[model samples]
Target: MNNLNTLIADYFKDSIYLLIENAIDIHNNAINKPNDIYLSGKLMAYVEVLSLLQMQAQAFSIPLESLKLDKFEAEKDLLSSRIISKEEIIKT
Candidate 1:
């Protein structure tokens, strides 16, 4: 039973990583285009999904530290900075 639980945890962790990667990709495209409402909406949806996943994981007592969410957050911050820079350029 312990081994089975480990397997299930590993599977969910892998799925979370995939979801995070997809969200990063969506964020990249959204930043590059800056005008595509659809991509922005999709990114928003991904964020919601990820949030729910994290909440569910916590509810199940899963250790979230292993998820490496900081990397995702750093990437998101970088992308957000690019968007801000572009907006500033456009405004100036």
Candidate 2:
């Protein structure tokens, strides 16, 4: 894989991991509601969609431009771990 391809690949892989982590966190928090509440149908659907998306992503790769349009990246901090961080634009 070339530089751009590698970047795009890393972006996709890291993105999926981030999505799962976020979903789990949100789901855990949601289930913590009072009165033994469960996850909403909408959130369940969202997880299903993410599952399908991951399955599809495993087989196919999209263009970097498309990923750029969505603007997600695995930025590393002092913790040195991959995470979906907001993009910062520096106007020069």
* TM-score result, candidate 1: 0.66
TM-score of each: 0.66, 0.46
Best by lDDT: 1
Which runs in model 1 stand beyond 4 Å of their true positions?
57-62, 70-92
Looking at model 1, residue 65 earns an lDDT score of 70
Off by over 4 Å in 2: 34-42, 57-92
Query: How well is each residue in 1-92 modelled by candidate 2, as lDDT tens digits?
Result: 69998898778767755664565444544555424335445446556656466445445674534433223222212112232223331111
RMSD of 1: 8.4
What tens-digit string does per-residue lDDT give for candidate 1 at 29-67? 888888999987898888778766667667988665765
Candidate 2, poorest ten consecutive residues by summed lDDT? 72-81
Rate residue 45 of model 2 by lDDT: 54
* Cα error of candidate 2 at position 73, Å: 23
